[model samples]
Target: MSSAQGGSGEREESRPKDVEAEPAEAAAETSAPVAQETSETPAAAPETPTEEPTPADEPGQAAVTEPPAAMEQAAAPEPAPASEDPAPPPRAQPPNPDGEAKPQRTFTPDFLTELFRNPLDPGYADAAARKAAGNGAVGVPKKILSGVSALTLVALGFLLVVAYQQTVADEPARTQARDTLIEQVQSRRENTTDLSARADQLRSEVARLREQQLGGAALAELQEAEAQTGLAPARGPGTRVTVGDGPSPIDPVTGERSTEGRVRDTDLQRATNALWAGGAEAVAINGQRLTATSTIRQAGEAILVDFRPVTSPYQIVAIGPDALQREFRDGVTGKFFRALNSQFGMSFDVARIGDVTVEAATEPNLRQASPSPQASVRPTSSPSEGGR
Candidate 1:
């Protein structure tokens, strides 16, 4: 019996690791009945109990339970969550005509995502990566080119420094020259004003002498001619018409201001003509007297009267009879201006303020035609000439 037990222990030792993991409790039957020690023929032999060995007693048994990581990997898969927004498909392009195949565009998650995040161009990023990786072997030609480029950049920097220094050095001289020119212009303007005042004084003296020398009829004729020629200032009760620019409404389709709403030279000319027709003795626009030969025309957006620009809110004052306003407002030209006011949102006002003064205009240069020697003779009215 001792030999059989020795063989059994040797067999158990030689078994595989899986068999060693089994608990020592397997030999006992769970349904075995407990013996009752009631003097029944010297109590039956007590049955041995079965108990499993702890993991400390059986080290090889721990290998049967898997690790947490292995358990997670081996777990049954669940359905994937639905994607809220799927990636867009690639953009399509037309087929190449030259048969050189164009690379198909692929969906890139970072194409737009990195634009604002990293605004550097792809070439710049590549250069940065290359620089970070350190430089490789450079050829002789490329090294020479790089040296020359560095030399050129240094030279340009030096040139800019020199230019800036030169400009700074010349600043005082330039300022002095500019000041001299300004002073010269101011002096010339003052001289011209003095000369003009002197000439006006001389002219008044000459006029006084001539008035003294001339008879009543001749003096009266000269004064009337001066008044009519716009060489002398006029003053009287007259109608005043002020015309201003419109609101300058823009065209909705073209997105430009409408020209019809703007005041033009033609409008001033027409108003002046209308006032003349209404028996205006003298007329002026915006304090500038209008002469017979004075021109009213456009220079770009400006309205020039005798080559002098006039701003908006043109005020036209005419010296004429009390019937002057009535004739002008009731005339055909009045209706035309009314149309402009109604259609273009322009401002038109007519008033007769008491005694407005009109300034004298520059004297006009005139060349009067003369009769020939033969044409100057008066023809004698005779019965013989009448019969012929």
Candidate 2:
């Protein structure tokens, strides 16, 4: 019995040991679950995310998840959008609080394209075309100005020409009238008003005719006798002179001066000299006698002979021996006339008159008469005065 009891005691000690080992093993297994839970808690905490996380904080998750999908999409290339403007929406937007819809912009692209394509504008294409074709600007402004200027000049020239023409047209008539006037005045100057000697001669002729109061036959004989006497009629040998103004000096180019042309004083003097050398007894220019008091002066285009105005076609009358006059005209003076015709185109005419009678120059009239003495006492003494 004592041996049995020793064995039981050894078993019991061993059983205690095994029991303690079991508990220890169970504790180890339980502790292993707790450790696993701790590891899994950290992973769940990341998923639990207390707030939104930034990309940097979730980098690892982002890389593993979203990045793979994005990378795959990126691998396929995409085309760029076209430059065309976006189309408008089908529906219009609601009006703003102001009750007005926004105005849409309308493009004028078509109009602009047409305008640019046209070649008529002031652009490079038009300029280039004109240059290549060697064309210049042709329009209204230039032509109008040129035409107006030409017309104005033509009108002005016409006016000037007309004025000159009028002056010339009146010259010939004026010259003729002036010549006539000068002739009358010169004749008056040469005539003397001395009547005393003429009255006495008239009384003597009356007394002689009265004393020859005879019958018809006797009267006829006395008349015949008187006729034979030198005093019966007036007769004399005299020269006839003619002075005339010549034509205007010939224009060297045109060969003759127009009506408006000027006459020279020198030409007048030359004509006068020719007449004198022609043996003219007495010469008168215009109507003025070629006396010492006469002078040929220039007054404008006309000439003045002894203060008497003379125009063209002046005539000088001379009285002298007809033969001598004929010789004078046909001699050197005639040669001069020929030269005048050929060189200067002057006109002249010479003629001889028969039975030329020249009256002597008379004394000028004196008008300052003295009052006649009262004839009351002389009336009775007229016969008594002759006796005394």
Candidate 3:
């Protein structure tokens, strides 16, 4: 009976051992399935150990035996060797204790940590150089790549500087070409106007000779025509008139005023009319004479007389008898000038241009009027030229 009771105690202890072994066997079976699931999931879900109890944590002899037995029933040993060969190298067992080797801890000094903290230090460089020496061909390509990148950047910068200089060198020639074009356009416009005026003057002279003396001697005929039609050359003593305006008015939006300002066309016309009534025979504006066909145009801040730009301080010269100049200086026209100065703050000056040449205003370019009376009788040609 005592042996029976001793056997019963042994059986009870074995039953608890068996219970622990069962869990270990179950864990071994489950681990393969769990690891497979971990591999299938995304890289974010790695095989980290959970906080729950595992058979591996129960480090007893009975628990240790369970995996070998479970694995033996599930798969053959030799078949697993190919997969286990790679896995065991990464997780090599540490040295055993109690007559087994104590683990030799290799003090690696956390080389990665040192590399991050002392990236630019010579000490780190020496270690990296040693590692690179061991790596051989792998490190040589990296050095060559860095050197090539630096050389490429330098070449690009030099090309940019050369291109910029070439562009700057071309600018002056372009500006000179633009100025030449503008000058040629202005010269052509002036020449065209002068030619038209000459043709008209020749036609007027021919008409006069035919009118007075149909068959008189040429010299006698010329004198007769000149006296009859007031065709004598225009010549007289003249007064000179200069006109200018007040300073520019304030700009309402910008609140700024211009310093160099001048008179308007209306103001200039008023002064010209005053001189005409004062018995002036011929009037000239900015060296251009007034004629029946003369046009005064304003462009921006300048006045254009026959396309010639004239600005502030305009000079107007007129030719007539000397009696007209003296009379105009103190006559009703003189009062008009004073009133304009007082009312609008305009400026004016009058002077006598002695022996001034007031050439006859070129005869206007006449579009053939009634084909001139001489059209049927006189010799026909392209067109006659004259100096007016």
Among all candidates shown, the one with the greatest TM-score: 1
Give the poorly placed runs of model 1, Cα more than 4 Å off. 1-169, 251-255, 362-388
Query: Which structure is stronger by lDDT: 2 or 3?
Result: 3
Q: Give one digit per residue, the lDDT tens place, for model 1 in 30-145.
A: 10111111113211111100111121212222222112111111111111111211323323323433221111112223444434432323232222222223331234466786
Each prediction's Cα lDDT score?
Answer: 0.59, 0.43, 0.50
Instruction: List TM-score per model, in order.
Output: 0.50, 0.28, 0.38
Q: Which stretches of candidate 3 lie over 4 Å from their true place?
A: 1-235, 249-254, 258-261, 343-345, 359-364, 369-388
Going through the candidates in order, what is the number of backbone clashes in each? 0, 16, 1
Q: Candidate 2 local accuracy as lDDT?
A: 0.43
Tens digits of lDDT, candidate 2, 1-388? 3332222222112111222223333333343233333332222211111122221221222222221112111111111111221323324333333211111112222444323432222222222222223332335465886899899999999999999999898898899899989998877655533355665477568747765667578766664444222123223343443434345555799886663233356655765576556555555554455553457888876688756687766665565556755675677766766566565566666666665433222222224877556555667557666776
Best candidate, lDDT: 1
RMSD of each: 29.3, 46.3, 24.6
